[model samples]
Target: MSIMLKEMKAGDQGRVQGFAAGGQAYRRKLLAMGLTPGVEFLVVRVAPMGDPVEVRVRGTSVSLRKDEAATLNVERMP
Candidate 1:
């Protein structure tokens, strides 16, 4: 099953499943940031206010806002 990125906790692992809402430019930007489907990532951290959450992907870390991440679908991994 797929879950929203905003629902994931730190140390969680998952694969990019798909996006929920985004225009062409937004989609392209996320793709450019390496958030394409099938890519695997690990939740690294969540800010105190929970606005931006960090994930480790492609050997680097990327931080995304909760609203943006809420549009993301991720299949959790064991």
Candidate 2:
């Protein structure tokens, strides 16, 4: 099923479907953080209060705010 990036739980892995926002710069920023569409990522942790979420992508850990994370659409992996 499709879900917002911020909604992913710890240890959950998914492939990026798309970004909610449309813009070259926004896409570039996400790409810079290794969050390119079609790339797989694992949710590592969610900070208390859930403002920021940590994810493992391309062997690197990146933290993103809920707003930013929400922009990403992902599908849970088996």
Clashing pairs in 1: none
What is the per-residue lDDT of model 1 for residues 1-78, given as tens digits with 9 covering 90 to 100? 999988888999999999886645457667889999999999999888887999999998999987778778899999
Worst 10 residues of 2 by lDDT: 20-29
Cα lDDT computed for each candidate against the true fold: 0.88, 0.85
Q: For model 1, what is the C-alpha lDDT against the true structure? A: 0.88
Best by TM-score: 1
* Model 1 / residue 57 / CA error / Å: 0.7
* Tens digits of lDDT, candidate 2, 1-78: 788887778988999998886545466678789898899988999988887899999999999887778778899999
Q: Largest lDDT belongs to which candidate? A: 1
> What is the Cα root-mean-square deviation between model 1 and the actual structure?
1.4
Residue 51's lDDT within candidate 1 is 72
